[model samples]
Target: MNALVWYVIMKWMPKGSSCVDFVTQRSLYEVRKRPSKSYSWVAFMLANICAELPWNTLMSVFIFFGWYYPIGLYHNAEPTGAVTERGALLFLLIWSFVMFTSTFTHMIIASVDVAENGGNIATLQFSLTILFCGVLVSPSKLPGFWIFMYRVSPFTYLVDAMLSVSLANALAFCSSVEVSVFDPPSGQTCGQYLSACTSIAGGSLSDVNATSQCEFCAIMDTNAFLSQVNSYYDHRWRNFGLMWAYVAFNVCAALFPYWFGRVPKSAKKN
Candidate 1:
């Protein structure tokens, strides 16, 4: 669903249609380009990586503006009330589902196949990833097992959680997001913009009275976000259950196949 939507938009993109779009198109020339079960992975990774660049950037931009992307979309309009941003909630849910589905499917099947087939695992992974770069590429894959991702949400979640772990790992490098004194605002602070937090949305907040920097503010916001996400575990057992399930499944997914398939075979050969 997400792949189809993304590719459709890309088709109309002023730049050009992406390989994902081309691959998904109902045509022989395009399908011939796929040539393997791994074709789906090629499409998946491309869409996944591309999806992040925009979504993450947008979320960060929203924060840079005054309207903190609400962790939850609850709203209050009349006489102290609360309502959810239905659209935002829907978007997040769908996006999460789509991105997770593609990435998890590709990484698992391709990694397994490469290791089993005596292929350069690194090259196999890289090539599949690059195929996501709108390039024609593929990974080694078993027929039925590899395509199993075509419609498996549970397996998708495991793959999705592992991918999320990988992403959080990469982003973990930036222990903090600092807006230093020298870091100029991405906009001007003249007249209407003066003392206001200028953002892409034309929203701004007056600088904290006599505040030296907004980096601290940024940090607080981030801490708040982490706290909020962590708080979800406390707010509902279902959330806690989901996180544990995701984590457990990811561990088992990565470990079971590799540990059982790799070590035992080598040990037996010994």
Candidate 2:
């Protein structure tokens, strides 16, 4: 994708020209080259999407069957049985987001490279991208300024969408039993009233009394777990739409540098 952007910029723009001059010339040239430019742009976008689709699909399948299904990660209190569909959709959305964002970023970086006379900043960009994308820290934990970056980062949406699809309806079951007290003053015992004990939501230990001895039932429902981690599931599909919108924005943004920052071969001699 980066190479493609570089090629497009080099081929279309005049050399040894300032970004402002390149924009002016490109606009004039567009009148005659509009059709070709349009075709190339569409072709590039389609190629990017196509190239990534199959691999992403295969990985999604592997994760669903290998990790989610076998481990019962999608099991819920209601057992809706739509785990496969939801999980597949989630993965597809994530890939779509990744592909578009990558292309957009590459185009921007390519523009920068051209503007800077080909000084490499790929490493810097990669590190910044990762840092801002909520990979190193959860968005909820970030400070105010960084939180803005977290919200804008596509990874945030991806994580939310995945969590929603995978664990939205999941119910955490008690995997073991240990003798414990529910209420000491009431003389209630967990072992004596096993059926009365209910599965607790994740991060809800505050509701339990301090004297309660049921320390073993700390399991959480899927939704509750997500809440505890400050990840939401209510807008999973909405986020998918947002991701597509971001892709469109990237496509549009790529045009600016292509037109304004590109240098033409003729300008190199001057």
Candidate 3:
């Protein structure tokens, strides 16, 4: 089916330049440096790519999918769950793979910047690919993708960001790799609320089942405490891979220091 569609597009496109060639040429021409600073609009991406690998990966994934599915929204009460599920999967898989590819592009530039042949984007890309492989590739909600970003988290987003930055740092050291801090926010969680139970039965709201209520309340409190501590270490102990995962994160983050594409060729230098 895809082949057939491509065949039709190629057949219908104006001759002298086939569909493939047309796109290839256009990409090449557009990417070529110019006086207008046309690529500046995409400068955010280019600059971040040169700086932060994981972050760039996170942001790029959100942007690409957000464009592809502009209405990728999460309802307060997502009906049927199917809508949210589809949106999340699309966001995760598509975004991760696309961004996974971007890591290579970044590494190439990183090595060039540092004048090192071994320090290519491949490792950075690999780390991200592995990091997000199961999480995104597997069926999951988009909100779940960013549980780390949720304000409801016991800690503030700043703390979470610091935790991640730190974890990324640790990864760089253990793996003996240079990690770059380049990712910026690409998607948002929209709105969220965090309300603790202020009263028991009938004080402010309707009476509830004590057994169930206490059980849940206790659970929430425990999770809240652990998540807060996790904020300190970025939940490193959650998995054994953390030993090296943090190592990998720290590796790519070297370029950042501050803790913060597609195919096609180029036309020519302006």
Best by lDDT: 2
Candidate 2 structure quality by residue, lDDT tens digits, 1-270: 123222322332222333334334344444555545554434443444356447645654654455545655545423877766776675566456545544444444435534343223433443454466554576667788777777776556655666666677766544435223345445554433343345322222323435455544555566665666555677788878877777777666665555465533245665
**Candidate 2 positional error at 77, Å:** 9.2
Q: TM-scores across all candidates?
A: 0.24, 0.59, 0.22
Cα RMSDs of all predictions? 20.6, 10.3, 20.2
- Tens digits of per-residue lDDT, candidate 3, 1-270, equal 123212322232222222233234334434664334555424533454445446645765655454434432333114434445434443443333334334333334322323233233334434443333222232143257554433222112222222332222221121213221222223311111112333331112112322121211222222233242333333323322323333344336433432223322467998
Q: Write the per-residue lDDT of candidate 1 for residues 1-270, one digit (tens) a residue.
A: 224333422332211122223223423322553355445533543443456446644543443232212422222111123123323333343334333333333334322433233223423443333233221211123245544432222322322322222122111112334333333345543323333443432222324332334332232222233332222112232322443454345434544454454322424563
- Candidate 3 Cα misplacement greater than 4 A, ranges: 1-89, 106-116, 119-214, 218-270
Model 3 lDDT at residue 191? 13
C-alpha displacement of 22 in model 1, angstroms? 26
Poorest lDDT segment (10 consecutive residues) of candidate 3:
188-197
Give the C-alpha lDDT of model 2: 0.52
lDDT at 176 for candidate 1?
Answer: 38
